[model samples]
Target: MSLVKESREELNLIPQVMHSLINACVGMFASAYHQAENKKQNLLRTDILTEQFKRLLLRHIRTHKSTSDYAESLNISPAYLNEAVKLTTGFTVGFWIQQATITEAKRLLYTTDTTVKEIAYLLGFTDHAYFSRYFSNAAGHSPTEFRLTHRK
Candidate 1:
């Protein structure tokens, strides 16, 4: 039957039947709407999470050696957090971590006469050669070449 016929099936159909259905639907909709509002009030944005990730990363760069360890401290899978970091901040988690590492590398290069090998270990590279390669790729100059050219 058509919806109109179905609703009128009791044969006493008039304003009362229409009123009951409208009220029922409105009640359920109101309950769902309020639940959604409450959820919105309770949750933080992904951007806030990204900011927290940056702060934790800076702390780790100062004190630790690994992104894997940092992600563990934040209680999230590194891969999942990396994806969120990319989406919200327009940079991979690795990208920021690498930037922080490279920044420190640059600081030590310019401000101190520390050997590149020493700076590499201080920044947590397992091998001096690998640090040289990684630093060259990131800064577009070998660590020594960069220091020679850029230092004041």
Candidate 2:
């Protein structure tokens, strides 16, 4: 074997493991650098998302409406709302809306003895399949699985 192979054999690690470890280290370093940049940007523009987030949270928790509705309520275009949300939360307006709705759905599924259809409509999804699809996409499981996990 070569010197490199000998060194790796001494450490009981394969060449692939060494490459993977180096890649993981680089990934972690890049993540930390990006996080620091994000922190600096947030410090420079604190609460810039407060109004929009507040409006979003209120309209969402209260009514769980669509992004277009929220953007119209805020009197800006949907694109602008999406941009604001991305700047504020690292997510688009639609993402937050869908995720928030799914979160509420999870809460109901885990805490209440409610039917999936009822919870679906309660969270503003006109159809149960739509709610199920959205919930599964966000939680990596179906609402029934979620409920089963948390059943009392």
Candidate 3:
């Protein structure tokens, strides 16, 4: 008779113990899930900022040549903009700006018969000599050289 009563008591305690264990497991899972969600949201926000920065760069590459310029337009700090862009695209903001400038310069050089000085001015460079040096450094050739070699 004592053994039967003890067994009944143990059986009654099992439900309470199981309920506590289940609640703990649920709490842990919920915490992990919320953490994952927050991380995903942060990454998504960074990606959006990166895309916005790229669009601004393309639209204002000729006029806005500085990282601060684009960062200001996007309402973000230059450091944060660069960090977000670098994280999402694996490159800095200045790199994309330079690429946009050089790509446009190349297109104009290849397709038009504009003088190098005129091309430099069109690209928002105040000095043709400086433009030439910049182009040479980024493109591995002078503007005139690129035109001559690339133009058939």
Q: Pick by lDDT: which candidate is best?
A: 3
Better of 1 and 2 by lDDT: 1
Give the number of the best model, judged by TM-score: 3
User: Model 1 — which ten-residue stretch has the worst lDDT?
Assistant: 62-71
lDDT, candidate 3, 41-98, per-residue tens: 7777779999898888888878998889988998989999999999998999899989
- Score each candidate by Cα lDDT: 0.84, 0.76, 0.92
Residue pairs clashing, model 1: none
Candidate 3 clash pair list? none
**Model 1 clashing-pair count:** 0
Model 2: residue 132 alpha-carbon error in angstroms: 1.0
Could you estimate the TM-score for every candidate? 0.67, 0.62, 0.71
* Per-residue alpha-carbon lDDT of candidate 2 for residues 21-133, written as tens digits (9 for 90 to 100): 99999999999999999886766232454366656675666374666777677677777777777776687767777667777788888888899999988877788998798
Worst 10 residues of 3 by lDDT: 38-47
**Winner on TM-score (1 vs 2):** 1
Clashes of each: 0, 0, 0
Local distance difference test, candidate 1: 0.84
Model 1, position 52: C-alpha lDDT score? 77
RMSD of 3: 9.0
